[model samples]
Target: MKASIASLTALLVTSITALRPVFRPRAAAAGPFLTQVDNETWVIGNELWNVTQGRTYGVKLYYKDHDCVGDAVGHYVSYNGAASNLNWTSASIVTEGTIDGSSYIDVKFTATEGDMHWIILSGLAGAYQYFVNHNLPTLGEFRTLWRLDNTTFPNGKTDVRDEALPPLSEYISTLKVQDETWLKPDGSGYITKYDFSSWIRTQTYYGVYGENFGSWYINAGKDYYNGNHLKQELMVHRESATGDAVQLNMIHGTHFQVSATDVFPDGKMWGPWLWYLNDGSKEDAELRAKHEFASWPYAWFEDEAYQTRGSVKGQLVLSDGRPATNAAVFLGDSSPNKTALDQGSDYYYTGYADEQGNFEFKDVRVGTYGLQAWSNGSKIADVTTSFLQNNVKVEKDHLTDLASLEWQVSAKTKLFQVGDFDRYSYGFQYGGSPYEHGVVDKCPADLTFTVGSSRTEDWCMGQSKLGNWTIAFDVPKAAAQCSSSKKNATLLVSLAGYSTGVSSNVYANDVLLGNLTSGGGIGTNYTATLLNDPSLYRSGTAAGEWRYFEFPFDAAVLRPGAANEVRFQVTRNSTWHGFMWDSIVLEW
Candidate 1:
């Protein structure tokens, strides 16, 4: 009984010692066991069992973060290639427990099966790494890479191919095969699988040996190529590919001769044959010289060439060469000998005088045109200004001048400005001083008005009654002393009157204190208004600037050169607000 008790105690002690936690290996604490399988890298992070495919092939990753406290637990692959959730399915994992009562972790994996060539299990987002593993095949599974966003190859429609799929078998072997190891029947050479970075370097690398290279296999769709290689072509851009530098094996025996400035350049496009070719030697070039091309004969004066007309410029002037303002101009051709177009039936356009008296025609065809000018909408005269012969017979390569002729417009009478006035007094215009008296202060030369302000004062000389009347400035002349009967003479007046209203019933045009009241307002105390209308006047609340008023008298109104009487009337409401007038000038 003593021996049995000792043995049982020892057995229990041994079991308790084995249950104690063991320290994890230091080497594994830094990282997981790393190895390459089929040119891919596999790593075990905090989440165990991670796999990464290299750049050549699409990546595959694996990760796990599960607690195994009571017993060992991990995922496993069954014989049928399906994975088992429990870790005990495989005994291949090497494991250890933590000393500080933490959970144990382990990772184990094996080769994959089936057509799922690319798979991933990752904890980090957007992180990618490459490796050279011995597990993956040199020639990967053949599949469609990418497709174009445009239509089919040009050549019209009749040359469409039946098969749109790529030759995957041929592509798989060719692409994976290294440049150093060309295709050999024995297949013993080292097959190289490079990523997009290495491929781009290989393409853009133009070295001293004159070896030109480019991406032979693009993501472009198969629809771009017809049965004939003549349909689609590749261009060498950036670095020009000379004829001697062409890579025979770049496109499976296909070669291109192109410069850095080819049509496609670095961008891929599908177009006609000649647009893609850049053969250095004329032996393969198709040249079409301009001199060798056919010519279409036509005559034109290139300068005045009006093709589809909207607006065009034509010049005109009076006979004395002064700028003819307000002259009406017409454009069209009329000659009895010329039968190309009917004189009256041809297209025509009319132009009105601008400030410079020049006219322009719109929507007229390219041809010679006649011009006519009139005054008062009646026929003045028809002078032969140079006819506009637009796009007429001329050398095709040289430009021609069309505006080489001059127009001489003539008129019987010219108008001019005589002595003008803002306001004047007739017989017995009273209640004002000598400034209001009807007489020339100064004729033909210069005249100035002397302004005197009186606040709520009585009427002055030449006036009947007065409230707040300012000294009036007047000028007297007959309308006959002014310009021609065909034109209008103008007198401009600008002044500010007191804003004193004599009676509520008196309109601005009605007589107030024996004289018609023009304008007097209380708003803003200062404003400019036109004095042309007899019904309107400008009055102010206080002293303000001179505001202009112009009155245009036509031939009938002016009595055809009769001198006119003008007067400046000043009256105001409230009797206190007023201003003075000064220095008035006249111009033609």
Candidate 2:
């Protein structure tokens, strides 16, 4: 009996110890341009930038406990991929007053060139470390780099580069360009949302090795604004593979390239700094080109070219077979674009039906998106953002059919989960925000569902861990006019456990849904949901096997017009049994 007791205690201890995650701390709120991650380094803004001429540089930084009340001294370091070799040099700091009404450090520094520069903010106890690159000359045009909530690595390394998802699979497809509507400048309008497929032609070019080792490929379907404030479609056929980078290049003029005087010896040097699309992925692509491929590769751009466009079109027939004109069709998805940037706005794309009940989405990007349509009598019909579900799958070089879109709004609608699809599989996107992710650092297996199974592996993660795990997707818009637009929306999580009960406080947009308990004895043997409570289980039916834990909410729980966030706060009480999260899905 004594030996048996010791063995039991040891098993419990091992299970408890197996669940902690090891990674950088995540921040809350919109990240400032600078975050003093540790006393040693800061995550500097590394957006599409190139310093035209070296001069006095300054930025507002987020520091703890104190504002910029005084000046301090610090050091700057340059990095080589070589972990052991680093060039550390001393630098000076001067304080500028807090801008606006926030507590931040405004540090001013003088530098000649910028190459992923790293610095430590001087302080008494834990002096803060920060990173900034003065390489981009246009200080006023600089966009904030690394979301304030993203990770700040040890050196001035980029979070995206360190964690970026693998390059999108290469694909060849056609881009579809729909019609343009000519409307008056005034409020009252008159025009057409017609399908003019292939109005725009695309060309592809891939460069092999040259004398300068400048091998590159331009696989983008190109276009410019036909008119100011013009909206059109750039469509691609959906690929057999899921989300991928859609390479797009929109240049201003004849200027082929530009440079960073901050990094070059003389002002006469030039580079591809300005030629590429101006967004957050510039320097990241540079680093990837240098290290990963040893050459610059194309990237996915989140935003459509300023005047570029794409559309989802189809006639909605009413119950009586009449055209449902003026009905609203929405395209929503939170999956990352090929460029892997989440601009938030990319989550919702909207279009309206013409008098013929023909609806078209004017501008959309590449990725898997969700769809919802609403008419007069009823509203909020759930649909997948795919070719089969009347949802538009926008790929490059292909045009989404203007007549392929269709939906029927109802009084109360539903969504049934299709388990075999990877659209529901998620660890986290490559180079996604650092705060949310698969527990790859601690539990390697918790990143995704087991092959052909809907539940997580029992040993995946958390013997006794606390915190939140969340997944987000574009929310299908509930009916705007009617109160009974959508009903019976529930989040399903399949879990299994042994000795202990691992539970989480389920939340949809911070509103409490219910407690999801795993590994605990259910009041009844199983649950009855519209979608099968199971996807194919690999384990047994006891406490060690998978059981359904659902978080049911009202139709109103769907947010107004953007991504719907589903978060799980692991607030478990230790019985020291085994527990794991298998599958999570939204079924209405």
Candidate 3:
């Protein structure tokens, strides 16, 4: 086992904070959405809906990661009220279904049209360590738009407006980051306006930065169209010192407004959606209160101009021609934008194949795009004409249907392979040292799959370790041993040729089971357990004592059933000779 692979990762997010106080009703980290299979594995999901302007939407509620797999569950709440009345009503996530080969859940809301409803999505899964580089976008869409189109100014300036507003009206094309937060307050060029004579002229502006947030305004709110002038720079401050050096053009958009009136809930005044997704943290609150994370509140990505020309539909299949449900599919245009295209592009659009392997891309601009599929981080093989060989064309006025796309990818690691999180989601822990060593076709093991390309022998010996290596299993709830009334369970460990000066201890439900420095026959490389194994037919001079040690654990440290967590570990503080583990057994 590589020491690099044994490090622990922060597995869940806890809270949320929106742009303002009113955006407060938006849910934040509502406790970690996770379920542990064992101490070794678990899954997480989150809500990520991209509502279009027509309210017709497509969404990827949870982004997949290396280890997590499952579909996101959503609910339509407030049964008693009308559509408009229930738009902001709060609700809980009712259920979730697993997607075949994908890591996260997906939903395309076009089929559920006419329902203008509010939603609360579960969260996504991953080992999120650095907030600064984590792909989860805090402020995806930072832009400006004119609320009302084709308006005349009191000065008789017809269409005397900013050309910059057009880009903001569309989704993702003109998206900008709040990286360089503060605006040049030196009356810098604010040129996207036209003087009354229909003659375009440049204006000047200045801005200020707030804690975790900031903004820029046209200098003096210049006289034009009765203060309806849409010359502003929308910005969003990042939670960390710096966001990704390259930002993603990924958030499915709903509002691409360069002006205030364009926001939904038309009757409102002043600010855009002033929401705060309460993630139960002051720092998170302060961060969210400072900037707009895209068109969050009006997240519906739509406009009459955005139609078939910007949309696409397709299907997916496995190598065997069956529906490849839940495979992660990505579309991107190296020319328009780059994304995780692995194709060297930075802009991209993401979604997953549904139960039938069907998929769609909403709110796309007219351009050429390439498609890619992935399952648990490994790229799936495309058996058909190479999607990478030719870029698919997404023209205006029509939906590009590629018929059916095929993907081929599968898990390779064996279930019994030590530290394998994908299979036995067990409580496996390691520290101090990492190594692998064991007799082939000798020791009894539980893993059913083969290790690597060839199997030299049948049983797992362990990884070969030189410096130091450790392995511990947190007995899962299902195979718990201390459940009966007698409650006393003894864990027997088999080892061969281990380093000297080894110490042992066990933990149940996180409670320590008192340390035990001595076991059955120490000093010799072999413990009592190893000597008793009938399978150990030493072919050559035996390396170590090849012994076994038994540690009796009392009921006080172990939980009967509810808190069924059994942890055991062994460590060699000083370097001498490394070791090999044959098997472990629990006797009541």
Candidate topping TM-score: 3
- Clashes (N, CA, C under 3 Å) per candidate: 48, 39, 70
Model 1: CA > 4 A from native: 1-312, 335-343, 375-406, 414-588
| Count of backbone collisions within predicted model 2 | 39
Candidate 2 residue lDDT tens string, 1-588: 235223322322111112221112123222122332223232332111111111211212223311111111111222211121122222223332222343223333333433322221112111122223434232111111111111111111121112222212322122111112222234233121111111111222211111111112222222211100011111111111332111111111100011101121122111112112111333433543344232211132111332244455566665435565555554554332311111122234545566766766544545455554443211212222112143447765455764534444232333323221111212222111121111222433122222223333322333235655555555434532243554667666554222234555667778777654544422422322211111111111111222445566775777645666676566654322223433355755
Q: Looking at model 2, report the run of 10 residues with the lowest lDDT sum.
A: 252-261
- Could you tell me every candidate's TM-score relative to the true structure? 0.16, 0.23, 0.25
lDDT of 1: 0.24
Error of 3 at 128 (Å): 28
* Model 3: CA > 4 A from native: 1-309, 334-346, 377-389, 408-588
| lDDT preference between candidates 2 and 3, better one | 2
Quote the positional error of residue 503 for candidate 2 in Å: 7.4
lDDT string, candidate 3, 168-267, tens digits: 2222213321222221233332111111111111222111122222122221111111111111111121112212111111111211111112111221
